[model samples]
Target: MALILLADVGSTWTKLTAVDSNGSIVGQASAPTTVGTDIMEGFNSALSEIRGQTGSKEYSIYACSSAAGGLGMIACGLVPELTGQAAKLAVLGAGAKVLQVYGYNLNEDDLKEIDDLRPDILLLAGGTDGGNKKILLENTQALADKVSPLPIVLAGNRNAIHQGSEILSRAGFSVEVTSNVMPELNRLDIEPAREAIRNLFMSHIVKAKGMETLSRRLAAPLIPTPAAVLAAGKLLAQEMGELLLVDIGGATTDVYSYGGIETPAGMVRKGIVPPWDMRTVEADIGMRYSLQSLVEQAGRENILAQAPHQEQWRQELDKILTYPNRLVSPGLEGLEIIIAQWAVRISVQRHAGSMERVYTPAGATDVLSGKDLRGMNTVIGVGGVMVNSPDPKGILTMDSKGLLPEKPRLMLDSKYIMAAAGLLAGSEPRVARRMLAESLAAL
Candidate 1:
């Protein structure tokens, strides 16, 4: 029987899954993601174990990675809220943590900050096609020869991309030029830039994260782990109809919502993208690295209300803060569940939009901002929190009550196979669909 392999090399663990042509589960394995030295050690270790279990050497391998702070980026554009926002959204969709955003121009201070941050990639975008070219050209000139070897995705004014590309290329830098992210006002085209980011991650980010060995061994381009999961979520949503995905992890919580949104008649959405079939990563609400921020947001009142032993729980969490990899704490199940719940609440609150009263000539009217996922029928949970918790669905149903209007029937990705299925999505659609259906069956 022909076999296929899929893996997600995450920040703490490398999860490996082996499936057959029909998407039948063969075996699975995991190892601590080796980061101190070479990452290939852990990647190969998991692969070897899965191979040993299946006893098969001939298989196609596809992988995604979120190791070592996956794909940090800084975005620059002509306008802070316009094209810059487009660039930010584009990179974020490509599984990147946009650390900083700049608009108009880049000076010595900006360059220094970029150097200091040393982002995985720089997404430079600006003006609509046939619009302002001064900022894109000036920014390119300032960045030329300064940020050498650091890859830049020039997705700016189409009229100026040629000149900007020439300037940056002459300065000994790798540049990927894509079409304007905002070809016209209120028209955000991010697919080209997103594709560029993915391609560049394969070409340059692997080396940046010390995954050269794994990169060389892989049969196809590696995807950012978050992007891989988002792809899987999209595919599953298409098959199963509208769905919401909340994946809680050590460093971040990502929420993916899929559906076709109905816009108000005659009103154009200019403030935010529809974000339909899109993913949002909440960097400040994880179980470990962002635990403090989570605590601050969730508040002492909420924690005490849920877990009365707040002091004890906080103490245990403090220890885990030092080492986020120790996500599973024995005898601290209650605390972990509560933390995951808080993460779900805060993350979903941010991921989904709300309506507010706005004053107009006609009087106060309701204006909706962001994607409304109230009508979602399926809610899939993944990551350590959902997979390990005894009551994984509780995190969404009980804690995510206010944010999610209607209770979404819960599904869990306990096998850590969703990302693997996402990897398969590119190669075998039928198999990917079947595997995800199998996962959702547990709901």
Candidate 2:
């Protein structure tokens, strides 16, 4: 049978899925990520498992990766609020870990930090079409002095791209010029920058350490794992109106919200420029690797409220933190489930904007600063704990404290299909949509 293969090379585990050409999911397999050795070993193992299960070896593969700590990115813009924030959002929206963000022109300390961070790619954006050339060029020249070999995506003032490119090129840096991320005052255009980041992910990231062979074997451009998730989430939201995607992993809990038609008043009231999609990564709120930080951030009370044995669980977590690879008996599954609940609860709250009353000269008014997710209709859960848990729905019900989505239906990506569907979205949108609908149906 003709088949399509999709995989996500994640930090801890590599998930692989096989789908028939008709958009039906066929087989799914996973293996511990082989980061210590050749990372391709994990892929080989997963592919072999998939072939063995499906009883065939003939298939085309598409993949995305969050291995090697994913892609690290830094964006520099002229203004702190307008263009700079847009650049930062674009970087996050593209699934890169934000190493640092510089709103104003780069100084000595900033350059030193960028060099220390050693981001895989740097995004430089500022000004509108014909506005603010001085700061863009000033920032460009400053970058030329320090960031010698880094690949810079020049997405600033339209009029200054050429000059910026020339300066950076002369300084021995590779420059990819894209349209301004903030082409106008209240207009944010991030597609070009997002595409640039993806190109770098495929061209530079996947092939960086020792995976050249794996990179060459892939048929499609390898996307950042979060980007693939976002792509699949966006498509799902298109079909199901507004939707929220919660993915809880070992190291991070990522929330992707696709606000399609139904939007909160915050989008207009806060002067949000081109508000449609949002992706937030809560680094301190994961289940395994970040349990300590999660506890520190979410507080002990929040976790105990979920009905988990507190003291013994805390001791196990302490051991797990130090000896991460120790295969503990699976008796702590109850605590794990409670951790998942906190991950979803806090990550969603962080991803969403809050409504605050402002005391202005004109009567008191309310304003929002982030993407409001209260209007989303469904919360789709993806990951092992989310899909496997019997009461994933209960965890997803979210405490009634924050600006919660009212009566939103709960869905689960039971087949581990979100990342795979995201990888297939660009080439075979029909297959992606069909696979998502087939497996991730509402509960």
Candidate 3:
């Protein structure tokens, strides 16, 4: 049968899925991602497993990758609330990890931190269309002086583009200019900057990585894993109604929400309104590699409260933290499930919007910031924990305290097809949507 092949190359694992011409899943397999060596080593290994199941046949292929730390970037802008946040959101929407966001002008400490982080790209955004240009130029000069030659996407004030471009270009840094992220107060124009960053990621960063050979074999440009997942979430949201997707992985937990930005009744909106389709990656909250930090953040007492054998579970957790990749007896799997619960809970808490009681001279009022995800229609859980859990619904359940969906249907990405389907979204929307609909089944 004619078939389409899709792959997701992540930091810990490379997941593969085979889909038939009729948008039906055929087979799936996973192997450790060997980005440090040849990424294809793991890819071919997993491909061998797929071939074993489906037989060797000519097939179309598409791939997305979050291997080798994904696209790391540092955002520089004038004000913390205005241009700075805009710049950060632009990169995040492009599926990049914001290493740090610096407001005002760069300083010696900021310059030192940039060098230490050594991000793949620098997003310099400041001022409005004709607002403050001093910091825009000052930050550019600072970047030009102390920073190494790296790709820079300048999406700052339109008036300062020429000067900023000259500053970086003269310093031997390649700079890509786009429209201002925040042209007017509370008005965000992030698409241009997002596109610029994605273009830079494809043209410069991905091409330089070990996956370059693999990208040459793909049907289209290899995208970041999160970007593909975000695209899949958007596509699914078209049919599923307002939704929230939480992907709990070993190193990070990413939360994506769609079409819930409307202001709730009896509440005043504050801060920059997030995009309808939004994503937040909590780096410190994860299943394996970040388990220690996750447990610490979730609090030992909280974990101990629900854990079966508190002291023994804590000891086992310590061992896992030291060697995150080490597999334990299946009996200890309960501990993982407990951690997954906290992972979902804590990650979503950070991702969701919040309400605060503010007193004004007029009277008391409720103010909402970020997307109001309360009453979201659907919540889908991705990643291995959700897929393998015996009780995914239990893990997905959020306490009444946070601003999560109220009584939303829960689903799981069982075949790990979200990112793979997203790789095919541009080429075959029907197949991508079908795969997602079938794979994301109710628990």
Q: Which 10 successive residues of model 1 have the least lDDT summed? A: 260-269
lDDT of 1 by residue, 178-201 (tens): 988889875778889999999999
Q: Candidate 2 — worst ten consecutive residues by lDDT sum?
A: 260-269
Candidate 2 residue runs with Cα over 4 Å from true position:
207-210, 260-268, 305-310, 321-331, 359-364, 400-402
List pairs with backbone clashes in candidate 2. none
Best by lDDT: 3
Q: CA RMSD for every model?
A: 2.5, 2.5, 1.9
Candidate 2 per-residue C-alpha lDDT over 217-249 given as tens digits, one digit per residue, 9 for 90 to 100 = 778877888899889988888888888989887
The TM-score that candidate 3 achieves is 0.95
Candidate 3 C-alpha lDDT tens digits along 107-203: 9999999989999999999999999898999988888999898999999899998899999999999889999999887677888988888888888
Q: Output the lDDT of residue 236, model 2.
A: 87
What ordering of candidates by lDDT runs from best to worst?
A: 3, 2, 1
Best by TM-score: 3
Scored against the true structure, residue 29 in model 2 reaches a CA lDDT of 91
Model with the higher TM-score, candidate 1 or 3: 3
**Pick by lDDT: 2 or 3, better one:** 3
Relative to the true structure, candidate 2 has a C-alpha RMSD (angstroms) of 2.5
The number of clashing residue pairs in model 1 is 0
Q: List TM-score per model, in order.
A: 0.92, 0.92, 0.95
CA lDDT of each prediction against the hidden true structure? 0.80, 0.81, 0.86
